[model samples]
Target chain A: MSESAKRQSALGRMMLDEAFEARVRSEPARVAEELSLPLSFVLELAAISAERVRAFRASQRHKDAVRGGKPPTKLRW
Target chain B: MPRASVGIGLRDAYVEPLRDLRDRRALDVLEVMIDDAQFDRRRMDAWRSLGQRWPLVAHGVALGPGDAIGLDREYVRAVSADLAAVGARWYSDHLCFLRVAGERGPIDLGHFAPLALDDGDLAVLRDNAAALREQYAGTFLLENPADILGFAGQGDAHGRESGRRYTAALRACAAGALLDVTNLALQARNDGFSAGVFLDELDWDRVVEVHLAGGRRSGGLWIDSHDHPVDEEAWALLEHVARRADNLRAVIIERDDRLPTLEVLLDEVAHARRLLP
Candidate 1:
């Protein structure tokens, strides 16, 4: 992948990362300060990430509930 | 094609408010989020109903027009069909890529990724625009994405030197520029340039639409969140560019999250019209 493409991928990954989501959710003010953005903005980012996380988790739950415990092939994130 | 002098981004959250404003004609045009309601029959009916009162403009987020993959064939066709159904004559999306081929097949980036402002990227954009023009038979504009981090090749840390790059990209695409004033404000705030200085450098004639949205500061960056009212800095920048963007046909107020009431948004739209008028 090209350098720009890598950077783009990294950003998307960061958004989908559960750990990163937790950090943002737990310490929005610190994240805001570290990124030089307002707390509200940080909260918004957390909210978006949280929504995505919920959707992913819900999909996971749905898969686990069916399919005889076989791992699903396609992750929807 | 006819254009709206002032408009607002249509959101499901504002459905009732929009219904209230339907007869009043408070908005001259409505920018439909094509991706959200693409194949839903009920929503399509709603859009058709809205179309009766106001002209619609298609705004998408997942077309990935600037990516190496170019315009997704199915996505473009869906958008074009819907636009035609609604009698819209213009289509737009951010000049950024959101999906890429991954080892697992294709990965969807829920966020918009900034394209490098260079000859290669410009050529890709041009090709995508040409494809869109041929397929949709309508004016297509590319909106600049809010940059949280500066691109690799764009000069300086703040992407301050991107004025020519933006102009060049639009020229290459032969597409109208949908100038997102607040996105530029976020760019300036994060990258160390005055939004006014950046706006002054744009070739305003290329601008076909002006987007007014608000952002908030988080971490150490200003995000183009579109959740709050238009900020003072963005309004000032709009005032500077609104006079020179002679081709400007639409001024859209975009608020996606933490949405104010429809009346409040209509008031903002009124304020935008006053500024542009």
Candidate 2:
């Protein structure tokens, strides 16, 4: 990954699409002004949101496992 | 020199084998995952018998103390009762939130998630950790989970955030740390930093325990699967921690997937004994 790519938040990479990145890059000042937060805060919020989404998905998977939605267990090396 | 007690996670898959080991007094402590096993009726009786022989530590995955909404009181009370019954040395959980309110009720993420290395995350951990320490007896240690995916803006510039967050969390909560050596190696592998660099930034005085495990690299990121044997990188990190962390007392090998035979697990435990101070 490029240095800039590495700097992009994990949430921005995983959850946000290219269009969102393009918008942020194109009008960072306007976007930051509209959000009433720094551009860095916007990225931070996205990262936090990504973590929340991960927790929610993991919770659903656990619920499914509890309800016997998983396959039979077996050991695989 | 204070030496660290070497043990393994008493997973259900290895319970019978561990029982044999327990009878022989081959292990020091068995870190039991609190939510993975039951603690009533015959099971409780069985645990009481085992508790008489071997030391057990309660490790939690679903407690999610880092949740903004505060930890679940019911869960804390239940864990306390179970640990007391088993005579556990301490209780610990990852420094991340697992559950959040859903439409129905609380949803528990079975996996340990990562928290943002920031001030807001630090506040949540500090508050919840203090509350957990108050509600539960014995020691409460916090472990840093694997940061497989390097979060946004936490590249070279923000690499120091992790150590900063860990330092602040320990200082604010005044709790011990369960430093998972393998997780640190995994993070360092994926995030382009040496594990030692991250270790150097932590307040080693707060670390009370260490965890070593095996992991695999997929898509250039190392995942802490705990299925394979302990690798060299993890062992090197464990050695580094042993040399620096003066307060370290316990070292555990966590193997949940593809568990090998009892002999093989014991070999890993022996390896830990050789590396620890």
Candidate 3:
């Protein structure tokens, strides 16, 4: 994959996966190297607060549920 | 310029309430999500009927204009048909990418993803916005996403520089801005920038509409949940922009989740109407 695609995929993962987001928060450089993303992008991902990640993840889940015709999980504020 | 009209986003949960508001002449316009009615003929007919009573504006959620993979021509055509069916006044969509190219096909992120804000992304956005504008043949507005997660690129750490760059990008594309005040407030609180400074950096004339909504605090960060009442900070930003944006034509109260009673939204609409020049 190209560098841009790599970065976008990593971002996509960060939005979809809780564990991956935690790993990015704790070890940004390693994740950056693993994904071939710029360290700067990883650092930015690291700076994202855990609450924001959870909210984004919940939103994605809600959208998925809606598409599947399932009831959405209530998001905890 | 005419005084900006105040309105509310169209929600299925509030259709009856909106009809009452329209009858009472309390609502000015209705911003409908084109995607919601695109696939359902019944829903499209409902929106078309609503359009006969109130002027409708088209807002899309899944266009992903900033996506590098390129525009979804099929989705664009569908949205265009829906817009025409409802006689929409203008069209608007978020300036962030919602889809990415996957090996199988395009993957929908299901949420707005912040752009890298580099030259390459700007070029993609410019080309897409121009194409969409030409296709719509009417006012096309790009809304700033509520960027909770900051991206590392050609901008200052506090997000002011990013705001400036966004304004310049909109100007270059010759598309108007649907300046969402709630998004701006969320970015300021989450990214640690002066919201006033960010507002000042925008080219006021290009800002055609303003979105006002409430958000909740999560993990010490303000999330654009749009489930609460319009916060004071966002209201202040709305007032500030209302005074400055001479070309501002509309202000919409956007409440997507946890919708309250119609009276509550009407109050917000009234408050926003009072702020207009």
* Best prediction by lDDT: 3
Q: Per-residue lDDT for B1-277 in model 1, tens only?
A: 3433788898776666677664556778888877666535566778788777788887877777777655678778877888788777588888777676455656765556666666667777778787887768888888888766454323243354677677787788887889998888777766676665566567777888889988776655566767789988778777777777778788889977676888898889888767764
Q: Model 2: residues >4 Å from true position, as ranges?
A: A1-77, B22-25, B38-43, B103-105, B152-157
Q: What pairs collide in candidate 2?
A: A9-B152, A10-B151, A10-B152
Model 1 error, position B39 (Å): 5.5
Candidates 1 and 2 compared by TM-score, better number? 2
Candidate 1's docking class is incorrect
* DockQ metric, candidate 1: 0.06
Q: Among the candidates, what TM-score does chain A have in each?
A: 0.46, 0.31, 0.75
- What fraction of the true interface does each of the listed models get right, in terms of native contacts kept? 0.03, 0.00, 0.28
lDDT of 2 by residue, B130-249 (tens): 777676758888888876446533444345667767777777667789998888777776677666656667998899999988877554456776768989988888888899888888
TM-score of each: 0.77, 0.78, 0.87
Pairs of residues clashing in candidate 3? none
True contacts kept of 3: 0.28
Question: What DockQ does predicted model 2 obtain?
Answer: 0.08
The Cα RMSD in angstroms, rounded to one decimal, for candidate 3 relative to the true structure is: 3.8
Categorize the docking of model 3: acceptable
lDDT at B167, model 1: 75
